[model samples]
Target chain A: MESNRTESRENRYLNPYLGGVLLGLVVIAAFYTSGRGPGATGALKGLIVTGVEAVVPEAAASSGFVAEYREPLPGHPLRSWLVFQMMGLITGGFLSGAFAGRLKFRIEHNYRITSERRLLMALGGGILFGFGSQLGRGCTSGAALSGMSVLSLGGFITMVSIFGTAFALAWFFRKNWI
Target chain B: MGPLVIYEVISENINLLTAFIIGTAFGWVLESSGFSSSRKLAGVFYGYDMVVLKVFFTAAVTGMLGLLFMSLFGWIDLSLVYVNPTFLTSAIAGGVVMGAGFIMGGFCPGTSFSAAAIGKIDAMVFIVGLFIGIGLFGAGYSIWQELYLAADMGHLKISDSLGMSDGLFALLLILAASAIFYFAEMVERKFASHRL
Candidate 1:
């Protein structure tokens, strides 16, 4: 009975509404302090750009994408605020998982699928997301949430397209998640 | 006077530190809400779990209201806050692509980070793919530059576009959100027995 109770407690998560409130406050804090909302892809983009610059300085310097990113920087590309924020995200996530007893190195997948298949899907999904986010100028955090908060039209459009497409395609991918 | 770092009320270094602190709080809340589980995250699409919809809308509304109130109280300069620019073609196209990614991957960029933090190996693979995807995008920027920059409507507000007051639009959103929450609950119940 004791072990069962402990297991239940370990699996429990915070109430959804409460989590939303906390997340909102975090966004507000971000805006008030930095004049911008939270962003995840930008940080990743920064890392990618930094890697390219390190590996091929001439190529990176000549590229329009890399040039745009590097033009505004006075220091190393990796020394961006978004990069720091992403590091914080990692640290915070680890701490939370550790505290919640949820930190375990494992692959999560549908019962019917193998771990290898799941990883492949994940890789394919990530590639699509990364490419799309670059074109979209933001991901869920930067575009959808922050944009919606400010009542941006583009934000609304992006949100609709994203969720709508997902719903439309969810049926096809049902085997993966369901 | 708001956006302290932008106004130079705080040093750049301190602002960066704040980013880290805020990110920590963001990650903690996301993970605490079970976003670390891709299955749970995907449940929003399957209707077995509505946590994502509930949390996302609630947070957006809360932040919107908070920003409005703060600006009214003269505690912050809402005008200074960045609003994402609207590029019609790119937004829709990109979002469609992202949607496909979300269902297949069962996570978004932010949620994936939190999920990976909890030691999800799939999330790790997703991150590696993200790096490569981005690298490819940069390399091929020339081919899609036109579409990416097309139909630019600079920082347009939905409320303004609709001729509604910001406060009024926000109010309507909250009301709509409540209705959606009710519907979400019903859907969850219907699917609960089936185990989607």
Candidate 2:
């Protein structure tokens, strides 16, 4: 009974509205302090750029995509604000999990799919999201959430398109999730 | 006086520190809100749970209102804040693709990070895939450069596009959001029995 009760408690999360309000405050704080919104993909982009620069200096220097992220002589891509923020995200996530006693290394999936299958789908999805984020100039957080807050028309467009498409496609992928 | 870093009120190092602190809060909120779960996030579409919709829109609206209020009080300079530019073609195209990704992967870039940090192996794999996908994009940059750059609409505000005052649009959004919240709650209840 004690274990069951603890498990149930662990599964409980914060109220959605409260979570939203707190997240909004964080967004506000980000803009107030940095004049820019928070981002996740940009940090990953920095990682990729840094990797390319280290492994193939010539290719990194030549690629316009990579060049855009290349820092000045004394600067480095790893030193970017996004990268630091991402690190903080990981740390914060860890801390949250620890406090909640929710830290566990395991694969999370539905009974309908194998772990391998879920991982594969995750990879494919990540690829699509990453590629799309580049084209869209930001992912959900950077473009949709942060964009909408500032009332950017492009942000609205991106937000509507993303959610609309996902809703349209959800039926097709229902088995993997539902 | 706002965006203190931009106004030179704070050093660059301090700004980066601010990023870390704010990011910490961002991740904490996301995880505590159950964003770290793939199933919970996917439930947004399935109608079993609308936490994503609720938390997401609420946060957006709150941020919007907060910013408007701050601008009104002269606490922040709206002109200094970065507003994402619009590229119509890519915005739609990329969003369509990302929408597909969300349904398939069950996590966005931000949520994936938090999920992975909490030791979700799938989330970690998703991050690896993100790296490769981004690398692939870099490799094919020349191919899609035109599509990416097409429709050069400069930073345009939705309110300006609609010819409505910011205040009015925000009010409308609040109403729309409330309606959405109501509908979301209804849908979640309808599908709650179907949830796993």
Candidate 3:
């Protein structure tokens, strides 16, 4: 669909089903053309680890998580393809927003909350999510949906667990989204 | 004999290029569909917005069906695809925590990045939080080292778990997703709020 063509009704977005089809094709293309599915947090984690390793090699070497950055034998940690791929994600998102005229500087939050408060909440939420992704071994993108697309057991379990928990705790966080 | 790269049909350089291109498309679809918005993304939990449900379910079904068809047609080697190894304990436990994070943060890692691209400050803060969380996880890796590395169910597919054909499993997933899509519409209408 053209960027200009999509009409907004009740804060318009591309039809969910259509969006799914497009996303699904992307997954297919990713697998058939590249033999790997997409990922998000892995790249972010890589970037974080790479940055730390750059300034403090000893700390990077000694750290357990950064130990995954075994640069000498496994290769330069940041040079991995996922990092480049993630860069594309950011750029692609920017272009889409620019084309759609939706790009703006602001904090998104509920009407009941202040932007500052929303941002602070988002930071806290992000911390939990970031920690959770590592424990889960991937975020919603990598482990759950993409994983399930290929019928991976871990993906289904992770997907179910995450959503299930969300359902269980939605009432508690009602003040945030609803 | 498939999985073009694993079969040596493409060099690693080309592989990286493919990743970027694919990731670009991924971001485009996500942002254009409005997955970048925390309000919209979190609608799944509340009954108000079902974009997440519709898009997520539809995408899963599409991918599942496509993969099944691709495998049967010999376009891609089903066995060669990577399956995330199942670490039973952390998988469930980590997911529960992520679930809480989703309700709180309203954006997953991918969605947060998409929103951040459009200059959403909340998304940026969320990314910062993610870095800190990951850094903490890394720093305290030894604490989680045991449970983290404990499970040994190596790269099993859901199809094998229930002793079903891949196509059958995919079909069931499609059916389930369709149900969710239908139900999500109803829930959104019932719980529609002016919040967004």
lDDT of 2 by residue, B94-116 (tens): 99988998999999999999999
* Chain A only TM-scores, each candidate in turn: 0.94, 0.94, 0.87
Measured over all alpha carbons after superposition, the RMSD of each candidate to the real structure, in angstroms, is 1.3, 1.4, 3.0
TM-score of each: 0.97, 0.98, 0.94
Q: Clashes per prediction?
A: 0, 0, 0
In candidate 2, stretches whose alpha carbon ends up further than 4 angstroms from where it belongs are A71-74
Question: Quality of candidate 2's docking, in CAPRI categories?
Answer: high
A1-178 per-residue lDDT for model 3 (tens digits): 5644543432556777899999888888777766667878888788788788788888887887776545422777877766877988898888888788788898888888888888887888898889988998898888987898888899999999999998999998888776
List model 1 lDDT by residue over B115-152, tens digit each.
99999999999988788778878999999989999999
- Residue B97 error for model 2, in Å? 1.1
The C-alpha lDDT values of all candidates are 0.89, 0.90, 0.83
Better DockQ candidate (2, 3)? 2
Quote the chain B TM-score of every prediction.
Answer: 0.97, 0.98, 0.95
Model 1 alpha-carbon drift over 4 Å, by segment? A1-3, B194-196
Question: Candidate 2, TM-score vs. the true structure?
Answer: 0.98
